[model samples]
Target: MRHGWEGAVLKLFRGKDFTFTVTGAEQVTERYRRVHFTDGGLLQTLGVHPTMWVRLWFDNAGKPHQRAYTLVDPDVEAGTFSLEFALHDGCASDWSRKAEPGDTIEATVQGTGFDVPDPLPPRMLVVGDPASLPAINSLLAVAPKLPATIWFETTHDSDDELPFRIEDHHDLRTVPRPKMVEQVKADLQELVTADTFVWIACDTTTTRELTSYVLKDLAVPKDRVKSLGYWKAA
Candidate 1:
């Protein structure tokens, strides 16, 4: 299948193309699924980093569609990786819901990056939801020794079954969708300090608001905070 105009634009920006073969699939929760794949030489080519992700190309009635997914438990030597999907009403979710071994999918690598803070943060503050869970997991994997506090938003009861990486030193809170921003804001009013690294990935509006509070209200340095909108709330 051809990637169409979007692929053309990505290629113009030096995006590298690859094809992934599904090795297996599993259901983590009623609302979450995991698909395992052979990396199509992607891991060896560009190398790995914390919160690594790729743009997966899909067909929506013959038009090109793409979505970003974070790599889960990538093994460069074995050339394998996995992706976790937070099921929703969309083509990507539909694909993962029925994905099976032997299926192949096209993907592109572009605009994925991460840089660990120069002086390791004294504390890691993370705010995210199902859509960003895989990236949050990757970030935690990269800094296993750092103490972390995670505020995770859940929209469904099934979300409780989804596993989150946790260490004895980690503090985790699972909150519902309503007014999660307000709760997080109230909690962080006294938590922000000079030695904190704040990471946020959630719905667009919430990320924007929290980022503003972290930077403008709390005066945390931009370099110490990483923010991204994983999805747009509808």
Candidate 2:
């Protein structure tokens, strides 16, 4: 399938394209699915990193639509990884719902990289939701020894059933959609430290709001916080 204009733009930016073949699949919950794949030389060509993601091209009513998904459990030696889908009414979710062992999908690897802080922070604060769960899991996995606190917002009742890599030292807080931002605001000040690392990835508005608060109000250094708006709220 042609990737359309998005492909053209990525190509100009030197993005690497690969074809992934589905190896297996599992239903984690009514609203979540995990699909396994063999990474068509992507790992060997570019290697792997924490929180690595790829843009997958899908067919949406005869038009090429692309969605970004984080690689779950990426094994460079095995050349394989899994992608978790928060099931919803969209081309990406539609493709995942019917994915089979032999199915193939085209993916582009670009604008996907992560660097752990040069000197690891004393503590890590992560704010995300189901949409960014895979990234959250991957990020935490890289720093298992670090003490971290996570605020995960839930949009569905089944969201609590989603997998999270919370260690004994980690504090995991679940907040409903409506109260997530407010709850974080009320509680975050106490958690901030001189070198605390704040990572935020959620709906655009929430990410922007919290990033602003952390930088302007809390006076955290700009380099200590990594904030990305994962999806725009409709």
Candidate 3:
């Protein structure tokens, strides 16, 4: 007999793990790539949300360096998920760079991030570093077609910078890396209106600074602005 309510309870208590075999890898740019997984039918059977953050484990130096990545373009009907990685000089990046098709890795489902807010505001502002682009793009995909501004900062000036398409209702701006936080702040101070909702994702320092400016300096309510620290400088 298929375990029903008890299985749900057991899943919550015992936690289920997902193992995926890399089916394909495509380099989209010098600093970005897409990896496709072809395992984890059980996780799909358990009904995992598309936006849920998953912990990935790769065999590197006999220690699993865990990193959080958003599930991109999950096809429940097809039993697969796509994870986009931003190549950097780190443990996860090293594994991703060397990983090939048919390689098996482990992952676990965890972490929920910002969902679109209700009673939607008239305008929206999204600001983040290149690492946070996937989350921003996912938000934009589901967001109602409205006037939105996205500010992205990256070290390289390349045509293939970000992977996703911005709707016509969205405006995108790019700046160099070192001054991204300041530029975003200045943009918000000038462009933000009473009906604007601001979403920010960046390093810890940037998140703290921008959160304070939006809440204390601009008097935007905490509810109207959401900020998250996607990573921190070492």
Candidate 4:
């Protein structure tokens, strides 16, 4: 399928396209699904980076709509990876819900990159929702040695069942949706250090609010912070 204007813009910027074949799929929860894929030489060509993502093409009313999903458990040597979808009433979620082995999808790799902090932070303050779980995992996996305080805001009952890799030194706090931002603020007040690294991904409003707080109110330098809204709340 032609990707429409958005795809054209990405192509103008030299976005590389690839086809991914679904090797397997599983329902992680009623609200979530996991799909495994062979990267079609993507892993070997572009290599891998922390929190790497790709824009997946989906059909929305016969028009190509793209959604960005972070790569989960990317195995470069095997040229395989898995993507977890927080199911909802959307074309992307609909595709994932019915995805099975042998299904193929077109994807573009563009506007996805991650840069680790020049000097590892003394403390990590992470905030996110289920939509950003894969990214949170990738960031933590790349910096397991640093102590982290994770604020995971839960919207569905199954969110608590999601996997989190918490070491002895790491702290995980599952917050109700309404209280997430305040709780994170309270924690950051105590945890923010000269070299504290803050990461946030949630609904658009919350992400913007928290990003402003960290960069302005808390005085965290831009280089020490990373924030992006994974989805917009309706």
Report the candidate with higher lDDT, 2 versus 4: 2
Q: Candidate 2 or 3, higher TM-score? A: 2
* Candidate 2 structure quality by residue, lDDT tens digits, 46-80: 98888889999999999999889999988889999
TM-score of each: 0.97, 0.97, 0.85, 0.97
Mark the 10 consecutive residues where model 3 has the least summed lDDT. 1-10
The C-alpha lDDT values of all candidates are: 0.92, 0.92, 0.74, 0.91
Q: Per-residue lDDT for 162 in model 3? A: 63
- The residue-by-residue lDDT of candidate 4 on 80-158, one tens digit each, is 9999999999999999988989999999999888999879887778899889999999999887788888899998888
Error of 2 at 157 (Å): 1.2
In model 2, which runs have C-alpha deviations exceeding 4 angstroms? none
How many clashing pairs does model 4 include?
A: 0
lDDT tens per residue, model 1, 1-234 = 888888999999999999999999999988899999999999999999999999998878778899999999999999999999999898899999889999999999999999998788877899999999999889988779888889999889898878788899888889898978998999888788887889999999999999999999999999999999998989
Candidate 3 collision pairs: none
TM-score of 1: 0.97
As for candidate 2, its clashing pairs are: none
